[model samples]
Target chain A: MSDHKIDTHKIDTHKIDTHKIDKRDWDAHPPYVYPDYKSTTFRGPTKPLVPIAHTLSELTIPAFGHEQIQEFDNDLTINGRVDGEPQGERIQVSGRVLDEYGRPQIGTLVEIWQANAAGRYIHKTDQHDAPIDPNFFGGGRCVTDENGRYTFLSIKPGAYPWGNHHNAWRPNHIHFSLFGMSFASRLVTQMYFPGDPLLALDPIFNATADKIARESLVSKFSQKYSIPNIALGYEFDIVLRGPAATPMEA
Target chain B: MMSNKLKQTPSQTVGPFFSYALTPEQSGYNLKSIASPDMRADDTPGEHINLSGKIYDGNGEIVSDAMIEIWQTDADGNYLDRDTPPMDGTFTGFGRCDCEIKKEFYFNTVKPGPIEEGHAPHINMIVFMRGMLTHAYTRIYFSDESDANEKDAVFKSVPTERRHTIIANRVEEDNIVTYQFDLHMQGDNETVFFDV
Candidate 1:
């Protein structure tokens, strides 16, 4: 019943529509794990969460050239071959680099580092009692071919122990770094050998909440890739992103 | 939308062990192997500038174990994406550097060209460190390119108040130029990361 009229000039439609322009839908990425995991308690970034903006830079960066890679990086077997042949069960780890839709990610560069069969790294920080192999340098790099396939000849890494918890030991694993088509496409993950008893107890591997996704990190023994009496073969296909993509480290 | 049940694997810190494994170190024969982070040659053309910065965690403490990887187009804004050998040995689009004990990192390269016409001149960056399960992706924008930044589609998308966190401040001395941009993992001045 009042005589005052509503003021149209005071209203701003742009303010109400900001969500459409500002908020992005990140549907494909896996959710970040809960921070309560024992190991994450001390190591995880404790900063308050801040939302990220989806930008064209993430989607449109360049895929690097052959210059990013060098010759003879794929053959870890000989690369580690120095004073004598490395001691351990030899392994031929091979797989295809694929996208979410299973398309080949050709020419992707993959790098790997691991502990030698004696469960000791050449690094000074690795104070494990296991003897370090003088000849095994435990590192290799390779680029995906036209078919998106990459292979490395390395000895299977052995289990090592750390003081993460009382009696805690890490399972045999190899670290992988993949530079995909763009900066956003890069992924780093650890591949573990199947049937390793420490997989269940390792806090890092268990940090992945999904049981099925956690199991995916384990490489399977494949006779098809084995070099008959020369070395054992393991297959570990890596998916860089999307729904079916492999679980990656943050 | 997919179900949120599948959780990502938690990331462990790169630890002190990565010194030889990832960076340039001489403890082992193979450790000296792999890709070197050098991105420029003596004859690479363009303004030679030193890009430097330190990385801070949520507590604002320096993160010495972190490694930064940068990807940028040449001064002409062209990415060397050819399958064949390079026509000119000048441009290598990718480079990486590990942080020192002071939690600082630096890259010696030419200023990148604006990604697209009227876009802000920017460089793509990825961070890998202990604790981060996956690498964090961000971009560095030049503070001097205000006109282009204003029109850049990506820069415009960022909220005006938070955009300053990504801009590198420029300084010139002794006929040399240097740009400094700090990255904050958390807190009020947190850097703006991009989702692909």
Candidate 2:
């Protein structure tokens, strides 16, 4: 027990030599977690409110099978949708999970959720004018293959009206959840399409302060990934924390 | 080798918009998974307990839109790993719950067995809320396990004054054990959240 004892307060957020690379500034891009964003409610307190820094015990080492058990097929439309099919233009989303150094992250978990083609969620709280899809549960899970690549087939989510502003609307996007290797590797983000008119107006997307980091959230169309007469392909690669850490949701 | 020049993507919060798919109960569907907030069996060999608490922000106001996820070993100090199966099929060792209108969340689980020697019984917790871009991690140690808590590696790392934040109050009612632990997101006496 003595060997395991650590003085957590003596530890610095940065310079923690462990499996987790010290990335203290990674919290900057996240809006609600940092005090920089003024427009959002419950923003992190400005003064006299300091968040406790990370310590050794705080870094959870991922257990075996943590990212393995619940893996579904690369195609979400197969087992997730209500009747093996969902209405709307079927699109293929493929990406690689990588570390900040661009090294492949294999056998990692990637979960996703989104709105139906009608821009409405199948939720009791969602009272939007748009209709909910009976077939689209809008959620799926998959694990990165040996090459750190993963793929999902689903309908393109529609832009929906939000109450944030007078008539604010969220841009077309898909929610992504990834647990790369440890608790420090966990990330939840949204993937947006290119050239969306609402991207500029959306507060969440703009919450990221760095222009380059925000642009990374947008997926690009790829001719190589296109399925000829079938679904269009969009490629997005995710990077976990490190020197060039991904600016993730705090 | 590839140049590895592709930039990394930024992250966004799961937000208050995940109930439909992530939490199917709010969507009028019953999808069961390891994320359920209770992992106990009536016939299992251990003390049955209930954990209840409220989530508060820096202003001491309730955080109405919050979620809590807990994981722990079975009653016999055994974790469910790839090679180590549950003592029985009933114990999954994981649970998840979202706070309702009252800004309160609770979990019904058995007292976790120590994961390793010289450690007190504790339940691992992860908290997710609307404003939080990422989840917060903490552990719930049993206040009654004074001896074990004293030598526990994790508990020893916490400052003496702040250690109480993670120790739950044990109470018995109608022959049932319940642990009360309120989580403070910020402010003085804020619950200790780990970066994990």
Identify the candidate with maximal TM-score.
Answer: 1
Residues A1-250, model 2: lDDT tens digits: 1211234333233543444453423433454454432223453432222233443223443342343334343465554565557778878999888765555788776777788888977655678898877777777767678888988888889999876777788899999877665445567789999999999988788888878678878898877676787788898888776423223222
Taking the true A–B contacts (Cα pairs closer than 8 Å), what share appears in each candidate? 0.18, 0.32
Chain B TM-score against the true chain B, candidate 1: 0.85
Q: Which number leads on DockQ?
A: 2
> Which parts of model 2 have CA positions greater than 4 angstroms off?
A1-85, A241-250, B1-9, B25-34, B58-61, B76-79, B82-92, B101-103, B115-119, B146-161
lDDT by residue (A77-167, candidate 1, tens digit) is: 6775668988999999998776543546787778788889988887765789999897787777777899889898889898888876788
Write one digit per residue (lDDT tens) for candidate 1, span B15-107. Answer: 445656566542333344333345678788887888889987776678777788887778877665433223575556666776854468888
TM-score of candidate 2 against the unseen true structure: 0.78
Residue pairs whose backbone atoms clash in candidate 2: A250-B133, A250-B134, B36-B95, B36-B96, B37-B96
- Model 1's A-chain: what TM-score? 0.79
In candidate 1, which residue pairs clash?
A249-B133, A249-B134, A250-B132, A250-B133, A250-B134, B11-B133, B13-B130, B13-B131, B14-B130
Provide a comma-separated list of chain B TM-scores, one per candidate: 0.85, 0.88
Among all windows of ten consecutive residues in candidate 2 chain A, which has the lowest summed lDDT? A1-10
Off by over 4 Å in 1: A1-56, A59-72, A242-250, B1-16, B19-21, B25-37, B82-86, B100-102
